[model samples]
Target: MMGVVYTTFMDMVAERFSEDVLDEVLDDPGLSTGGAFTSVGYYGHTDMIKLVVRLSQITKLPVDTLIEAFGEHLFGVLVGKYPTLAEGRSSSMELLEVVDTAIHVEVLKLYPNAELPEFRCERLEPSVLHMEYRSKRPFSRLALGLIQGCAKHYGETLEISHESFDSEEQYETHFTIKRIQ
Candidate 1:
């Protein structure tokens, strides 16, 4: 069994990810070559795939090393935030903010399109976050890119950017997102 911090981190990561990438890949069949997937659409490029390819070409290190590094860094965030993961409920609200900050601080460098200027947790119950983004188009491709990119860095179980919206067309209005684990 995974340690509490490790498990919580992974679960949180998965919650932020899994959805948008799969949806992007499945929705766009012509996304990558050979019908083989290495692109996770997180950075709007097969950069994740290319990063692997480059690593493979440069050295003999196993690809799992790359993934584990991400997992390790993610775990570090959780451990730093809540050193006693095993003894607590692992407050979902706090976990959400931690993961969100991790994405902005780290993942944004990898996907430098729209910066997450402000991602505050306006309302935590039922997992509602009041977000205010300054993007080229509020409901445009860049917006989706921003959402999906951040989701990938969560411990490994986040689908924060995937679920269907009760509504999402309005530019200057509120939206609902499925609360992430």
Candidate 2:
């Protein structure tokens, strides 16, 4: 997709996407549009054919093409933040300190401050990274909103793909990821 456009839009929202909301939207069958299209404004699923037409015309990009591009873009952001979520595998072990289980990605484009938890991150291994973050107790709406944005931008299954940590120190850990299929 367009990095400059996407980042600029995300910056305005100040939040990342989440998986739950995305999944709900995707499962609707109305929002499919074969791929995420902006033609119909994603208003609803009342009419699938109209939605498809709008999606195609809105972005000027094919529905299937948009879908593939969207997935690639989201996954790219996921891998980029892998260090922030995987704290233990890294030598820095900084991002691992997070108490929230939200993915640190750019998918959150709908809400302000909807990005991942505020934390420090460092790369320890070529294949592994680490992060450090903190959160009170219980998940916050903002956090949930961020994940929803991710779902809207990417697929929905990503949220469920997350693995939470019981320890107060390790807020959450993502073991099996990229399950957006």
Candidate 3:
């Protein structure tokens, strides 16, 4: 996983909870990096899972809830760091449609080793998008949060329904997103 993910998660913990809570989460003896992460470095995905588990224990929040919230926070951080990703995109669906082709391509240019999810999208209607998300990691809830964040960024309201499938090889999810008038 990218270190920027860890750094942003840590920042989210601090901002949404408190610096003290962040300190507690980092103090977990199970973390390989000891919660020290740099934006340009890479770390094990297990370390991230451990951090989220620890935070969930400390905050009494469900792991899925925390991951989803982190995803939303991550969207903001990414947008702030790479404004070009959202540049000239007037709608969430517009931005999401190019994620696999444009955004991930740019991400790969910077970090070829970064493992990103694959997305296939179809326009079901002018106000509706059908998307399939596939990844080795189990983060479909996180993807939902990212979609929500995207909608919020565009000042749009969306009705999103998700169906998921999990297999030994990968996790797959289908999302139906409809813009609310």
Best by lDDT: 3
Question: lDDT tens string, model 3, 1-181?
Answer: 9989999998899989999999999999888886688988999888888989999999999999999888888888899989987898888989999999899899899889998999999999999999999999888888998998888788899999999988899999999999995
Model 2 CA deviation exceeding 4 Å by range: 1-5, 8-55, 58-61, 87-100, 104-112, 115-181
Identify the leading candidate in terms of TM-score.
3
Q: Tens digits of per-residue lDDT for model 2 on 53-145?
A: 444454465654433333334433544544345434322122222323343343344233332345444444432334333344222222333
Q: Lowest summed lDDT over 10 consecutive residues: which window, candidate 2?
A: 90-99
Candidate 2 vs candidate 3: the lDDT winner is: 3
Task: Quote the lDDT for 3 in model 2.
Answer: 30
Query: lDDT for each of the candidates?
Result: 0.39, 0.36, 0.90
Prediction-by-prediction clash tally: 14, 28, 0
Off by over 4 Å in 3: none
**TM-scores vs. true structure, each candidate:** 0.28, 0.23, 0.96
lDDT of 1 by residue, 1-181 (tens): 1123223323433464444433342333333442233223223234333433344344455554434444444444544554544233244334445434564555456556433443444554555554433322232222333333334433333333323222353333232334465
